[model samples]
Target chain A: MTGDTELRDRQAMMKAALQAYVDRANAGDADGLVALFAPDAVIEDPIGSPLKTGADIPAWFADTVAFGTRITPVAPLRGSHANEALLVFDVEFTPPGGEPMRIRSADACTFNDAGLITRLRAFWGPGDIEPA
Target chain B: MTGDTELRDRQAMMKAALQAYVDRANAGDADGLVALFAPDAVIEDPIGSPLKTGADIPAWFADTVAFGTRITPVAPLRGSHANEALLVFDVEFTPPGGEPMRIRSADACTFNDAGLITRLRAFWGPGDIEPA
Candidate 1:
């Protein structure tokens, strides 16, 4: 394929992979979310938060996405030249007996050829949270 | 449709829109690139550069993507929750009778519901350029 076509195709694949990630998270399927990663994947959901890899990733998802947390894309998606991408969205976390808190943030991710995410670095902080 | 499917669909559309943008730029299709933006889209390429809007956007594309400049994504694309996203990539500019320079940068963009970009803020500086 031509260079443009190849690049466009890669972007599409990357987009699909990212969407699948959100899909899994939105479904509250912690296992599904973990399946999107490579065996050696690294995850830093909040940049400075504890780094997670391999078997440690699922727990992160379970802890984060549990209790009916939902994430929705608030803006358009942009692709970089490599298979790495940054995603910004609103994450709504509702504790069982607490109010919902909305946090706006983004994550940078890298994917392997198999389309599994190999690294994810989330960028956000308490300041990004929407006021109640 | 379920929320997951709807979200996936939106993500797909966003990816296609972003891909069209890079394709237009790589082909030196200045008009095509401009057409990707909404009528009143805002463009702040490099963030520090003069902001471009309305009729001024075409000139920005001409000046920036002109010559034999090529952009390649070094990372995957991430979509925000608001139809906005950030793209990180390397831009290679070969000035006529000048050496080629590769600069790494990222652009944060917002799109209208129609899939046309409404705002674009590029994040980069001279420091992001790679040494030959």
Candidate 2:
């Protein structure tokens, strides 16, 4: 494929991967979510939080799935000219020993050539959280 | 102030800078837009596009203003725990000799301690654009 065509294909693939992330998260499929990430992937949920990589990734998603997190996209998935995608969504989840809450989140994800997410940085400050 | 308090303040500053970006772009004030960026700021509009920095930054905004671009944010400005913020907006601009066009865009910006934008990467693939 031509360079332009290759980039276009990559954009499509990145968007598709983002959709799969949402679907898998909503399904409470921690393994499925983990599968979408590269082995060397790094995740910083809420940006300021600690990074999750290697085995920490699976553990993080396990906790995520246990929280019963559900993602509802507020805007259409956005793709870049490069190998990155953005997802703007509202997430509802039950916090440990607390009532369910909602947070407005925008996740910026970068993917490798293999289409696996290599880095994920979620943007959602404390002000974004509210009672669901 | 405490570290947490400092970070919170930074987040607020970042969000305000993003609002300024939208307002300045809509007002066609290239100088104002340029001022919000750090001296060493780098911008990649549409991600895959060429990077604009130093003198190129001003020229890029000059063309942006020349295009008569107006930004209408579709979502609230989202802040991160770190020095980053996201703005999802729809842009209406007139290309040279072409009719007005609309493009759905999501910009991720990283700010410096002084609240100036240090880096900006916009997400908007070909499919995200359409006739205005």
Residue range with the least summed lDDT across 10 consecutive positions in model 1 chain B = B123-132
User: What lDDT is reached at residue A90 by model 1?
Assistant: 75
* Stretches of candidate 1 exceeding 4 Å from the true structure: A95-98, B1-132
- Chain B TM-score of all predictions, in order? 0.86, 0.96
lDDT of 2: 0.91
What's the distance in Å from true for residue A86, model 1? 2.4
Query: lDDT value for candidate 1?
Result: 0.69
Across residues A1-132, which tens digit of lDDT does each residue of candidate 1 receive? 125566556667767877987888888888888888899999876554577887688777887676677878754454555566556577888766778787766766777878788998765543356633
TM-scores of all candidate predictions against the true structure? 0.51, 0.95
Q: What C-alpha lDDT do the candidate models reach, one value each?
A: 0.69, 0.91
Judging by TM-score against the true structure, name the best candidate.
2
lDDT of 2 by residue, A1-132 (tens): 227788789888989899999999999999999999999999998898888889999989998899999999998989888888899999999978999999999989999999999999999987788999
Error of 1 at B24 (Å): 26
